[model samples]
Target: MFLPPRWLQKDSFPEATTFLAAELSDQFLKLLQEVGPQSNEAILVPASQSLALRSQLRTELSRPDDFSPLVLEGMLMTTVAQAGRSLSRRHHGKPPAWLSRAKELLQDFAGAPPSIEEIAHSAGVHPAHLSREFRRQFGCTPGEYGRQIRIQQAKLHLTKTRWPLSQISLQSGFSDQAHFSRTFKRYTGSTPLEYRRSFTSQ
Candidate 1:
């Protein structure tokens, strides 16, 4: 079901297979455009729930009289929403080679991320240019992304181990437990203790 831009004009289906196709209706296309411009080519994301949704869709299609349009539309929209989210995380157009390298460096040094200048040097670009393009492409500054990565690591330790806040903070690149608590709260809308308590209680 991959469709390129203007696919209706360029592609044709055999009569037997026509029933298998679904048009990107104007209403749905408008909804997608509101999120962001639809990519010229479709982007696919491997989601765990997709198989379940597809199975449900098939079951509904088998009994057309019992099928609910609302449920069908929900399934279609969910798949589109997941793809849109994945696309937003990538560059608008084709990504530059350096962008991947820069992301790799960020993950490699998540515990102690490099400075903007250092990252630019590593990626073979000027600092100002890297900052501009990185933000434009990834939708966040490199430092912000690095902080998110650190916080995610800290969250894992918080849930999986009984480590004290101080130790988790140091290990996850925060200056102290207080700083970690504030940052974690800002990002997740829950303090470290609150987050862990919710998970443990569950």
Candidate 2:
């Protein structure tokens, strides 16, 4: 499961740990350094985004076509650059325990999520502090994270069931099919129908 280079092969992975690494060019490394926090500590990518990127890398690596390598590089570099922004030195270290509660509130919702103020009230933190820490620790605003969860839900529905877009939209917390399609396309770069078609065509 290890790739080339003595450094990359030196360490054994922990049990059940799914490790992923990409060798970056000097240009990309420089960009990452510039965009990333000025600290020497490791940058933390949020678990959900990390899992999504891992899945993408796995799929691209498994591809039997000529374009996989090029696509893989773009995907990895984009992930790195995007993750670098919120991982500042001040945001490092353990997040507050209540932050987990806040995340739970967002994730547990099946419809429109509660407002930021409500989430903060429920988590016993001030709205402003919750907003700041949520971005720092999770790499997204609470609202954005809620939207991401809904998108994940929508994708699951799209690939797993033959549900209509309107039904999936409501079930996934969108106001309507138009809103769902717009948000899904904004996040995924494809319409819901196109995304479903991809799975079918494959």
Candidate 3:
């Protein structure tokens, strides 16, 4: 069972038996407000989505102290936003054409992401306007999304290969190993070495 904050009192689930609970910090709540729907009722999550959430929850629980509170907060915010998107899609059909186009632009250029100005030029929009609209559509800036892709690639290399951290860092497009480690830990809540160890130890 999961519950929204006390302020979102319109939601209720009396029949739920198993609970995965967390205290929503102000930052998490703010993120929800930004990306989530303005709904009062509970949303039905599909079994596949629920299973994925359960896996992530278990991973977090297994090493509770390994993550910062901010990283945990981000995880919850992302989960809630995903559920909100599902609800929105069920009600409003698919996303808009412009959003789809923007997503395509982002994905196509993610490996070597263009600057916001360059992206704006490609989209025939002003940089400030593009920045605001992109965040509203995708919940993060284009640069942040590109960094996420790079970090994900780094994680794959860390798990699947015996390459040195410096090599992985360069391949992932970071300036150096230290920058890569800092950014990775900031987003993922674990250092690169620790992430690799978890895989190897298993």
Encode model 2's per-residue lDDT on 67-176: one tens digit a residue. Answer: 88788888877766666666653356777789989998899976657998999999999999999988878788898889889999999999999999999999999999
TM-score for candidate 1: 0.58
**TM-scores, each model vs. reference:** 0.58, 0.62, 0.55
How well is each residue in 82-186 modelled by candidate 3, as lDDT tens digits? 766755544555545554665577666534567777777777778898878665555566777677778888999999999999999988888889999999977
Q: What residue runs in model 3 are displaced by over 4 Å at the alpha carbon?
A: 1-112
The ten-residue window of minimal lDDT in model 1 covers: 11-20
Count steric clashes of candidate 3: 2
Give the better candidate number (1 or 2) by TM-score. 2
Clashing pairs in 2: none
Compare candidates 2 and 3 on lDDT and give the better one: 2
| Among all candidates shown, the one with the greatest TM-score | 2
**Tens-place lDDT digits, model 1, residues 1-202:** 4354575645332222223445556777776767754557574433233446667888888776644877787777777766665566573577688877887789878455689899899899999999888766765678877887888898899899999999999999988899999999776657899888877876
Cα-based lDDT at residue 139, candidate 1: 54
Cα lDDT over the full model 2: 0.77
